[model samples]
Target: MLGAGLAHAATPEAYDPWPGLVQDIFKSRPIHDGSGVIAIEMPYRAEDAAIVPVTLRSKLAPDDGRRMLSITIVIDQNPAPMAARFELGPDANVMEISTRVRVNNYTDVHAVAELSDGQLYVAKTYVKASGGCSAPAARNADEARGRLGQMRYRQFKRPGAAGGAREAQIMIGHPNNSGLQMDQITQLYIPAFFVNELRLWQDDSLLLAIEGGISLSEDPNIRFTYASNGAKRFRAEAKDTGGHTFRNEWKIDDPGM
Candidate 1:
């Protein structure tokens, strides 16, 4: 009966604790109205229930008026809830980012962008992937054990000749089990484990650092753009909820102007 109850549980309420979660991160009062400063991009229906891509863009000004300094993504019903937080660098032109996250059930995912002026802009979208994290590991537990913290990276050069900005994609292998999941054979709950942080660096300079909780998908994939001089190298280091760290690096060829 207990197993049946777990299998047949109703999806949790959508956007629960969203208001408080936004307020806690912004560290100031809330914006009663978020009309024009925020935009959220996500698919209406995910192609694969396991990997849903999301992007958050902030349209705030960059002067003393309102310069965006941070953004947060939250999936309401995940085990740890808070999905990812990104802190922007001074010259960071990264108003957009793409990442995959896990959805325990049908829920609303929120993107909150914060400006230097201490105001928060908010946007949200609903996703339909349910029980994604709780799904069994794609491979056997024993086979997945030794490869847990592995990381991979791929860099793509631009079309022209002179080196300029470039795009890179990083993927880290981790189960990101939401702890609510149970082993199919053993029927025991898998402990909660997920990626905690991912930092992107170019020539030892920080570009973006992401802090995540249990909402990240198994083997999270992140893609973002960065300014690149000719012959520069990029690196990413990630840490999981279980305190395991993995790192990967890539080099960009001469990018045409």
Candidate 2:
């Protein structure tokens, strides 16, 4: 619930936003500590506020018996606090996810995991970055316009991954402009134009699906590790706020395990 009334004028160190966030985002549901469920990796001080790297790792063992249904990332003080919600494929066995997000202020980034057993687990980490949501796009207008909707996919064989575990990355070219950013030439706010939905598949089965928001940085590259199902094809489909749809497919080469 980054829409309204969550804004605070108090210094980042003096104010707390987690309690209110729990109510608006989770409907007052109980959130347990996620130490045993998941872990969040981020820089203590990001070199660039506009593109801060964050990785979410599942902590459950292979024999844990419970699956991670989905995970939500929240940049508590960002203009749009809820950055993204990723739903994992039941059969993919996704263990890790990495992506970039904008950090508008020095704030606590929370990763809430919803488990198959109907429990919400929360993990927190502090990040020191500012002015991200309103930061100008890295590329010039012309350059950005040229690459709109371009998508790329790559798969990497994990050295010792069991059951054909593999690492893959998907990159989509889009400006992902937040409505808060000002256009240097026009001196007016840029209209929000970003990829709001992304879905990945291995052949006919879902691998992952993401519901995104303005807090996600431009370009939106997502890298993840999953147990490959010996499916011969990988596919991706993305949709933006402007209603443009981008789709791509690639052949999944055998890792020769």
Considering every candidate listed, which one attains the maximal TM-score? 2
Q: Using lDDT as the measure, which candidate wins?
A: 2
lDDT of 2 at 126: 96
RMSD of each: 6.7, 6.0
Backbone clashes under 3 angstroms, per model: 6, 0
What is the C-alpha lDDT profile of model 2 across 1-257, one tens digit per residue? Answer: 46444565332666788899999999999999999999999999999999999999999987998999999999999878999999999998999999999999999999999999999999999999999999999999899989999999998868877767889999999999999999999999999999999999999889999999999999999999988787899999999999999999998877343
lDDT of 1 at 255: 34
Error of 2 at 217 (Å): 0.7
lDDT of each: 0.72, 0.93
Mark the 10 consecutive residues where model 1 has the least summed lDDT. 157-166
Which stretches of candidate 1 lie above 4 Å from their native place?
1-16, 23-28, 32-35, 60-66, 157-165, 229-231, 255-257
Give the alpha carbon lDDT tens digit for every residue of 1-257 in model 1: 98888876865654467667656655556754444776778777777656678877656544436666777887776555678888865554565578877676677777877777677667888887777777776767776776787878777666662224566678887787778778998899999888888888876777788887767777778876655544377778888767788887776554332
The count of backbone overlaps in candidate 2 is 0
